[model samples]
Target: MLRFLIIAIGAPLFLMAMPAHGFARLTIDADSQYRYAQSRLDSGAVDEAVAEFNRFIHFFPADPRVPQARFQTGVAHFRAGRYQAAAAIFNQQTVGFAGSPLDNQAFFMLSRSHARQGMIEQAIVDLHNLEALSSSTDVIDQVRYELGWLHVDQGRWNAADQAFNRISPDNRDRFQVANLKQSLALSGAIPFKHPTTAGFLSIVPGGGQLYTSRYQDAATAFLINAGLIWAAWESFDNEQYALGSMISFVGFGFYAGNIYGAVSSAHKYNRDQINAYRERLNQHRQISLSLAPSPKGAALCLTISF
Candidate 1:
């Protein structure tokens, strides 16, 4: 009876333990794979991390960790500067993991990828969609700030102002917004030479170049035109009609070219000044966004500096 009791109890225990061991082994394998992939990413082994993430997704589609894995795959692409690929991955996650906590982050990453690729319109559209879809104030504020900066890059001053205005005054980005507005205003106020006026002034040879403040060019133009005119007149007085005609034609061509060149020069001068001003403004008006820790796992944060 004692032997029978021991066998009976040990048999059931063995049966339960066998299945538990199998389940534990499976769990360990899955977790190990996930951690390995994470470590690859942390070590900047982007390709290896992406491949590992793909394998994990394929093997454990239903796992709760799958969404994070998918997101990390996109991040790996982003870190490698494969922006289009990153965008594709992030965009898919937005739909594939709908309602997941990583949804907003995926959207933001998609927008940033587009922006990095110089697809400003697409970036703006993505940001707008993020604003509409996310209820998080932090996400919305971050999107607005991004929109503002994009507008500033495109020289859409009014649009930038409007975008910034939408952000609450109490938000930390308000000071940055003010600085951006001031920079835009100052850039717009930079004086530029009027092309039409420069052309008018060119009626007197070299006048247009002078008006553009190119004194050396103006002097060169005046000297060349005066010499050519004098040469043509002297040729005509000496009864060298053919030579005179040739010289006169050349002088007239130079005179007309001078006028056109001055107009173009003035326009170019204005453009150069504007570009320089923009460069200076850019140095002082950079805004960036990144992920930050939050009570709910992660959130977007905007950084601005001069």
Candidate 2:
């Protein structure tokens, strides 16, 4: 009686699980499944596309298209701004699918993922790794171009110029790189105000702020210092010696602060100009990679407009 009760209780649970197990085993056309996932991705339904691609990968793990599906999944995540997820997928593709046709692409995408998340130092390290491993002229040029932009973002102007200079003369982006180099050359003309000069000029109580083009702050500093000095002089003229001394002490504090603030404003002005120049240098920077098959073999084609 006990054995019969146990079998009856287990039978329904086993039956309920069987259909799901069997459905996973059902024969499906791998191409059609991959196409469905691709269609979802193409329609801009990123979340649904991720789900469908995951489904295809789950059902057709052995299909040749599985690698491409995985790559597309990473692309979908990247497009959705889910950079960490995309990085993981691309990183895994580089390792798990070693020697596969998409290896270089996976590595590049991994670096891109890191870059998008502001992990710039890590991204640079990854790009250096990619550059060292790649033998293709086109791929190397593309990597250097990206490296240049990364350096520009970090304010490493000399490093950026070096990277851009490494691109071959025959490459299509040479003109664009020349334009970038021209921009870098103009960086010196961005109207830098020396902090020391600002401090020295502040002896006149707002001269430094004027030098830095902070008109309103210059006016305010001038008024405050002038008022304090006038108060001290008036107190001394009235024969209030103690009050005059106190006023002079207060005026000195304001005068010293004016000098410090002027120096700080000069530094800030320089930073603002550098930041604006960096933005200009970065305006046209974009990199894309596509795999193309030739009669001899497959190669990665990297294209950059600037």
Candidate 3:
């Protein structure tokens, strides 16, 4: 009885331990690997997360999560400030899986990447594409909202207003839209100096600079030009033809430069005013988004404050 009992227990134990020696490796499945990649990303191990995500995509191309993995990889690149790479990946997501639930989100992200790279027109185009393709109100609203800000950045106030008007009344940023309109109305009053007017006024030596509010430059320009003209006239009166011609030539050069400088100063003044206006409008307003990996799919989360 004792021998039979020992054999029964030993046989079961032997059978249980056999697998360990049989080289049956404990393999991580797609879900576990994907979760690991996501955890790495959340922890700010961006490079590692990208590698792992690529691995998941490469090994589990048949898995539905591959799309999410691809997206997460793009998110990783985006978080790392590799905007071009992020854009490329997001573009693939948009093209490779057209009409998928993630399509709008991918387009939005791709546009964001382009915007970050200072490709504003390209970003606008992508957003317009997303707007046309998406049926979801939420997606359309997001696209229009982004389009409004982009137009604002480009100083297209009318276009921005149109974009803002198209957004649904239920948009959370409706009150902020009112503030934007108020600011846009004030934009007309922003100080501006016309380059052409400045150039034309420069015919009077220092008049252009004075018009542009460059008092010191105006005085300097006037004094220098007056001195050169006086010297050239004196040289001519003294019958020193060579000296008069040289002085006159140099004065003419200065005169031309003064005109060019005045036009440039006007442009600079306008730019400064526009930049300041933009700064005030952008102040206390922001919009940002990212893709969050999940078991079901990737969630595009937008955070906005105005």
Candidate 4:
């Protein structure tokens, strides 16, 4: 009877100890994995970090840090330039973790990833959603500013103006908006060369190039066509009909090419001027927003504004 009682008591104690020991081991493993993943991410081993995060998420689905793991995975994809994948992950987080603290951040990252991929429409949609969902005034202002900048990038000046107008005059971004307005006005006033006029001027061999301010090209075109035409005339006068025909054919080609080249150059010149102006505008815009690495060291923060 004594041996039977001891066996029964020990069996239950052993069963209890087994589960406790297993739980302890699992916790230790989870902690180690989390730390290792974070270290990998800090070291810029994005792929390895992503893999470790995946492993942790798979094994510790109920862990409180799972949300952070998912977010870090997306950030890893973003750092690797896998924008579509990053966007997908963030999009999922936005929906799956709705009302969670990470939701707003995920939504913002989703928009950024979309923007990086040149999916402007999708980015704008996400930004609008962020605006609707966020109660933060700063977040709303950032959304509006981003929307305006997107319109600027697409050269939709009217749309950009509309977006900027949404910002209150008292807002800190007022100066930036004013600068953008000035840039838009300047762009409108740029005197672009007419391609038709350029082509018409090219009737005089290299006159079109001269009109486009391509002085060296105009000189080169004029000399080449003039020399070829003179050669053709001399050959014909000497009764070398075949040689004269060849020279005439070559001369005509160069003459026609000059006309076409002049038209293209004029159009390109206009584009270049516009692009240069826009580049300066972009530089000024960048000065208005400050970007720095976030506390996580995995993403950037655009919080401080000049």
- Regions of model 2 farther than 4 Å from truth: 1-33, 96-101, 172-175, 235-257, 283-289, 292-306
Residue-wise lDDT of candidate 2 within 1-306, one digit each (tens)?
999999999999999999988567646687777778778888989898899888888987887667777888998998898999999998888774343347777877888899889999989988887788778787778788888888988888889889988998877464388788888887667888999999999999999999999999999999999998999999999999999999999999999999999999999998999988887887757656568332245545564533
Each candidate: RMSD: 9.9, 6.3, 7.1, 7.4
- lDDT of predicted model 4: 0.80
Higher lDDT: candidate 2 or 3? 3
Winner on lDDT (1 vs 4): 1
- Model 1 lDDT vs. the true structure? 0.81
Write candidate 3's Cα lDDT for 220-284 as tens digits.
Answer: 99999999999999999999989999999999999999999999999999999988988898873
- Give one digit per residue, the lDDT tens place, for model 4 in 1-306: 999999999998999899768565535477888889978988999999999999989998888778778888998998898999999999988885354346766877798799889898999999899888877666567678878877877767778778877776666465477777777777677768889999999988789999999999999988998899899999999999999999999899999999999999899999887777667667656523423222344333332211
Give the TM-score (vs. native) of candidate 4.
0.76
Question: lDDT score of model 2?
Answer: 0.83
Across 1-306, the per-residue lDDT of candidate 1 in tens digits comes to: 999999999998998889868565544467878889988988999999999998988888888778778888998998898999999988997785343447877887888889889999999999898888877776688778778777877767778778987886766464376776677777568778999999999889999999999999999999999999999999999999999999999999999998998999898898788777767767755455556333336645453522
TM-score of each: 0.69, 0.75, 0.81, 0.76
Q: Which residue pairs show backbone clashes in model 4?
A: none
What ranking of all candidate models by TM-score puts the best one first?
3, 4, 2, 1
Report the candidate with higher lDDT, 2 versus 4: 2
lDDT of each: 0.81, 0.83, 0.85, 0.80
Backbone Cα, N, C clashes tallied per candidate? 0, 0, 0, 0
Which has the better TM-score: candidate 3, or candidate 4? 3
Q: After superposition, how far is residue 246 of candidate 2 from its true place, in Å?
A: 7.6
